[model samples]
Target: MKHYIYLFTLVCIMMSCKKPYNPPVTTTNYNYLVIEGLINTGQDSTIYKLSRTVPIGSAIANSPESGATVTIENDKSNVYALKEIRKGIYAAGLNLDTTHKYRLRVKTTDGKEYLSDFVQAKDSPTIDSVQYEYTGNAENIYSYTHDPKNNTRYYRWEYQETYLYYSPVPSYYIFKNNSIVPTNADDETQVCYISDTSSTILLNSTAKLVQDVIYKNPITVVPITLDKLKVRYSILVKQYALTADAYNYYQNLKKDTENLGSIFDAQPSAAATNIHCISNPGVPVLGYIAAGSVSQERIFIDRSDFYAASVGVDYSYCGGAVITYKATQRTPYPDIITIGTDIPTDSLVAAPILGSKDSLFTIQYATAACVDCTLKGSNKKPAFWK
Candidate 1:
C-alpha cells in the first residue's frame, strides 16, 4: 500500500511537470529570399531555384517565388534573360563568353531586386568516372576527377539516380466497363523508371594536396535490399568548379542544414552568401552564385552483377495476397469486381455453374498499386534506358 502511494505521487508529479516547449526558430517568422543556382557556361542548361525561407514548424517545405524576371548580366554590357520553366525555377542556355565576368540578377513580383557579385567563368574538369562497388553491407557509388592544370582546387557535385522498378504483380488486364478487359496494346504497366535528385550538398577540395586530384569520393550509398538493386540503375553526376569563398559558403550551409541534430552536435551558424538585395541594402538574401561550366559523367549498374554474388533485393512491399471472388445467385454479378476492400486487378475468368441457369465467374483482385506499376511511377520507359 505504501509503494502504490509513492508510485501514484510520482506519476502525478510527472504529469503535472509536462509542458509544451516552443523554440524561437519555430514560432518566429523569418522569411527571407533564397536563391540557388549557378550560371552554367557549358552545354548544359543553367537553372536557378528561388524560394523563401519558412518557419521550422510550418507545414510547407519551401515557398517558391514566382513571376520573377531573372537574367544573367555580364560586365561587357551583355544580358541574357532566363525563362521561368516552373513556379520558381528559371533556366536558359547561355552562350557566355569565358573572358567576360558574369552575375545573376533577380526581380521579384514584390518589386524587390537582387544581384550577386560579378564572377569569372570557371571551367570544370571532366569527371574520370562514376562507379559502384559492394561494400559488404551496402553498395557505395563514387565519382573520380582530377584537374591537371591545378586551377580547380575546389569542386562540388550533384547527382540524379534513376532505377528500373517493377510492380509486385504484372497486370495484363485493366478494369473498364464495370468488368475486366485486355489492357491497351501500347500500354506497358509492369515496367517503369523512377528518378530522384540529391538534396544534400556534395563538396570537395584538393587545395591542401600536391595535385588537384580526387579519387573516388563517395557520392551515393545503395542499400543491399533497395529496389534499386532489383534491376538496372544509373547515376548521372555533375561537377562544378568553385572558388574558395564559394566553398566556405557551402561549408557553412552544410553545417547549418545537415549538421545539427543532437545537443552534442555542432550548433548552427550563419551561412555566407554572395547574393544581396539591391532594392533594400539591409534585406538579406540566401545563396551563392558563381559562373562556371559543369562537367558530367554517368554510369549504369546491372542486377545481374549482384545476382552473381547471391545478393538479394526486394519489392515485396508493393503488396501481397490476392483474393479470388466468386459470383453467386444472390449476387449474380458485381457492378464493381472489388474483392472485399481490395481493388480490382482486372483479372477474371468465366466458369459456368453445373446445372445452374446463371453463369458464374471468378475474379482475382489485388491492390491497384500492386497490379499497376503506373500507380507508383511512370509506365513510360526513360529515354536513356537500354
Candidate 2:
C-alpha cells in the first residue's frame, strides 16, 4: 500500500510539471524617430540625418526607409529640402542661420508625420592669427602659436593655405618709350624675363599629422577638394576645468608620465638649460623644478599637405607631446656683385641672392608645452623659498 501511495504522489508531481510557465508581458512601446548628422554649427549647409528606430531584440535585415520626405525649416523663411544622398542619409541643402532656431519635420509615405524639437546650432568662435616659428635644431621642429584672447572657450582650426610656385622663362624686356632692351646687349642691359605665373604644386609626401588616432577622431567624409588637394581630418577638443585634480589625472596618464616624473628630478646643472630649443639648442640646463599641476589645452588640425610636411602625427593637435623637424628644402637668395660700396636697391633686386623671395630656412610646427615644476633653493632665494 505504501508503494502505491508513492507512485500516486509521483504522478501528481509530473502532472504539475507538464503545465507550461508563462513569461511576464512587457508593455514598452517603441517609436521610429532618430536625428543624426547634426553639425556643430548651423552657419553652413549641413546634412540632417533621419532614421526609424529598430525594434528592441529585433534583427535588422535590409531595413531601409523606402519613401520619406524630410524638410528642415527655420522660424525664418529658410526652407531646406533634403535629398537622399544614400540609404538613410538625407541632406538638407540650406546653410545654417545663426539668427533663427531650426526644426526638423518628417513625413512618411503612410501618412504618418513626425516632428523634432527645435535645436539651435552652436556658434563658432573667432579664429585668431596663426603664427609659425621655425627651429634651428637638427630635429627640425617648428612651433606654432594660436594666441586667442578668449580664455573660456573651445575652438578648432581648419587651415586652407595656397602654396605658390613659379618657374623661370625667357622673354623680351621692352623698355620705356617703346625701346626694346636687346638680349646680351650689355652686362647691365641684357633683357631677361622673370616668370610671375604660379601653378598648383602637389607635394608628394606623407606625414604622420596624428599618431594612434584612438584619441583624435578620424574624418569619414569623402576627400573634399580644398583649393586643389585632397583633405582628411576629424578631431574633438573640449574645455575642461583647470584644477589640481584634473592636472593630477593628466599627470598620471602613461603619455604624460615622463614630464610628471621629472618634477622631483630637478637638479642644478653645470650649464644653462636651452629653454628655447627652437632658437638655441644644447644651451645649458639652467635649473630643474619639481612637478606641479599644469592645465593642458589644444586644437586639432586636419590631415593635409599643409600638415604633412611641417607637422607630425604626434604634433597634430595644438597641445601635448610634440617633436619638431626642419623643412626638407631650403630657399635660394641671389648675391649681387657691384663696384659701389652701397649697392643700389634697383640693382640689388636684379641679383639672385639679394632679390630671392624664398628663404633657405623654413620652420616645421610641432606641439609641446612647459609645465610648472618645483626647483631647488638658490643662493638668492626669495621669501617664497623654504
Candidate 3:
C-alpha cells in the first residue's frame, strides 16, 4: 500500500509542471506632488523646485509643477512669498531667525494646497577641508567637518563641479561678410568652462561616535578618463545639517527609489514624507522640507596633480573631417564651412596648399565642434574661477 501511494505522488508531481507565469501589467496611476529644497536661514536665497512624479517607464523623469504659490511661514505666522522665477523653480531672499520654527506652504495651479511639517532651523558647521585621494584610475573628493557642541550628528551634502575644456583644433578663421577672416587669439573660442551639479543623495551620520566628527566622508569621485579631469577642475560643496526625522526620510528614499530593482536588496517600501495634502487628508505627497543654514566650500584641482598614465581618454572623436577651400571654385562656398548653423570651421595652418602664384593658396578646414570649445561650454570664465 505504501509503495503504491509513493508512485501516485510522483506521477502527480510530474504532471504539475507547466508554462512560465506572466504577471499582469500594473495599471495604477500615480501623480503625486514632489517638493524639494530647504528653507534658508542665512543671507543666501532660498529656492524651491516643484514637480509631479511620473510613471516608472515614462521617458520623462518628473513633470514640472508650475504656477504655484509658494511661501515660507514661521510658527509666529510670518510669511515670505517666493517668486516663480522659471517653469518650476521658486526663489526668495531670506534672513530668518534661527530660533523660530518654519515650514513651507504651497498652493498649486489646480487649487490644491500642501504644507510641510514645521522644522527648527539647524546650522551646519564649516567644512574644515575638501580633500582628494587618487586611486588607480579615479580621484575621490572628500570633506571633513565637526560640531563642537555635538548637536549636528546627521548631515547631507550637495556639490557642483566646473572644469576647463579645450577644443582639439584651434579655430583661426571665421566666415563673415561672405568671406573667411582670421580669428583673433583673444576672441578664439578654444577654451571653455563646463559645469554640473550633484544628482544623487549623499548623507552621513556621526551619532554613534563620541565626537560629532565626520572625517574623509567621500562626496564624489571623478574618473581619470573623464574630460573634467583633463584640465583644471573645481568643486563647490554645500553641507546641510539634518534633523533625525529628515535624515531618516532621505535615507529611506535613497534605499527605495535610488537603489530600486537590485537583486538581494531589501524589499521596496514607500518613503514617508513630511509634507501633506491639506485639501485631501488621505492623498499622498512626496518630500521633506528642512530648515537650515548651508555651509559651503570650493576647491580647485590642477591637472599637474595626476599621474601621466591617468591623464584622460582620447577625445579625438570630437573633430576630424577636413574640407579644402580653393579660390578657383566659384558659386559662393557651400554652407559646410560652419558647424551646425553660424559657427565657422577651423583652418589647418600647418598643411595649407600653396598655389602656382605666390599670393594664391588653398586651406584645409574641419567642423566647428572640433575647433570651438564654446560648443560644449561657456567662453566666459566663471567669476569665482582661479
Candidate 4:
C-alpha cells in the first residue's frame, strides 16, 4: 500500500510538470499574403480573395487583405483591371483568348508588387449534374462531370447552397405604429431564404483512367437536423479545371491550412505559389493563379423528397416567452403596456387579466427576431427560386 501511494504521488508530480509550449509560429506575427481564386476565361466573373495569415489565438477568424490593386495581364501586354467587389475581394471577367497565356499582377497598398507566372487557360467540361441522396439522417451531395477529349485530367469544385425555411409559427399580423395591423402579402414574415458557400477544398483526378470522367465526387454532406433541409434546398456546383502543377498546389494548400486540432497535428508551412513578390523575393506568398473556364450545374431538392426525416429548427422558445399580460389590448395604453415594437403572438379574450379587469384579456408577445423570418434571412425570394 505504501509503494502504491508513493507511485501515485510521483505520477501526480510528473503530470504537474507538463507545460504547454507556444511555438514560434504562434508567437510570431507572420502575416503573409494569401491569394486565392481563379482567373476565369469565360463569361462568368473571375473572383480573387486576398487575405493575410493570422497568428494562432487570434480573436478574429479572418484577416482580409484590402486596398490591393489586382489585375490580369496577357502575354500580349493586354491588361484587364479588376474591381474590388468587397473588402479584400477583387473580381472581373476578362475577354480572354484561349490561345494567349495569362498572369495576374497585384500591387498592395504598401506599394509592393507581386506577379504570377504566365499560365495557359484550361477548358473545363460542363458539369453533367449535381445530385443528392437522402439517408434518413443525412443528405449526401455529389457532382458529376466528364471531359470527352481527355485533355482535362485534374479537377476542383466549389458550391453555393440556398435553402428556404420558415419560422415555427406564421405571424399573421405585424406591429406598426404601436398597433397590430393585418399583414399584407409583401409583409408576410413566415418563409425566408438563407445561403451558404463551400469552405472545404474539393478535388478529384481521373488522370490514370481510360476516360477523363469524374463520378460522384463528394461535394458536401447535409445533416437533416439543420434548417437547411427543412424545406426546399438548391445547390449550385461550380467546377474548375486545374493543370498538373496547379493541382499539386491545391492539394498542399488543403493540407497546410486544415486538420490542426492537436499539437501532434501537421504544422502549417508555406505552400508553393506561382505568385512572386518582386519587391522582396524572400517574403513568402501562398497561392497559385489558375486560368480556367468554369462549368456549373444546379439542382433543387424539395422537402417532399425527404420531409419525414427532417426535425427542423426548434423555435418553441419564441412561444413560451411571455413578455407581459394585458387587458383590452384595444385601449393600447396603461391598462396593458403598449407593445412598442412587436405584434402580440397570442391574445386571450373574455379571460380574467392578471392585476386588471375581468372582462379584459392577456396578450403574449415575442421579439421580432423570434416571429419575423426576415430577421434571420431575406423574406424576398431569389429570382431563380421556384
**Top TM-score prediction, candidate number:** 1
Q: Which ten residues in a row have the lowest lDDT in candidate 4?
A: 328-337
Worst 10 residues of 2 by lDDT: 368-377
Worst 10 residues of 3 by lDDT: 355-364
Estimate, for each residue in 113-154, the C-alpha lDDT of model 1 and write its tens digit: 998999888999989988888866677999999999999999
* TM-score-best of 2 and 4: 4
Which runs of model 3 end up more than 4 angstroms from their true locations? 1-29, 56-62, 173-188, 324-331, 335-363
> Which candidate leads the pack in lDDT?
3
Evaluation by TM-score, superior candidate among 2 and 3: 3
Q: Model 4: per-residue lDDT, tens digit, 1-386?
A: 99999999999999999998855655577888889888888888889999988877788779998999999999999999999989999998775788889999999988789999999999799999888988778889998888889999999999999999787756666666666666788887788898889999998999989999999899999988888888888998999999999998888888876766776878877667899999999988888989979998888988788756336777666763444334343464332235544555655334565675544544566667676777778888899888
Q: How many residue pairs clash in each candidate?
A: 0, 28, 0, 0
In candidate 2, residue 297 scores what lDDT?
A: 23
What would the per-residue lDDT of candidate 3 be over residues 1-386, giving only the tens digit for each residue?
Answer: 99999999999898897566666765455788889899999889999999987876777876998899999999999999999999999999989999999999999988889998899999999899999998978899999999999999999999999999987766666555666567675565778999999989999999899999999999999998888999899999999999999999989988986786556888888777889999987888888999989999999988998675866668666554544444444223445553243343544333335654322223456566676677788888999999
lDDT value, candidate 2, whole model: 0.32
Candidate with the larger TM-score of 1 and 3: 1
The residue pairs in collision within model 3 are none
TM-score of every model versus the real structure: 0.84, 0.28, 0.83, 0.82
**lDDT of each model, Cα atoms only?**
0.81, 0.32, 0.84, 0.82
Comparing candidate 1 with candidate 2, which one achieves the higher lDDT? Answer: 1
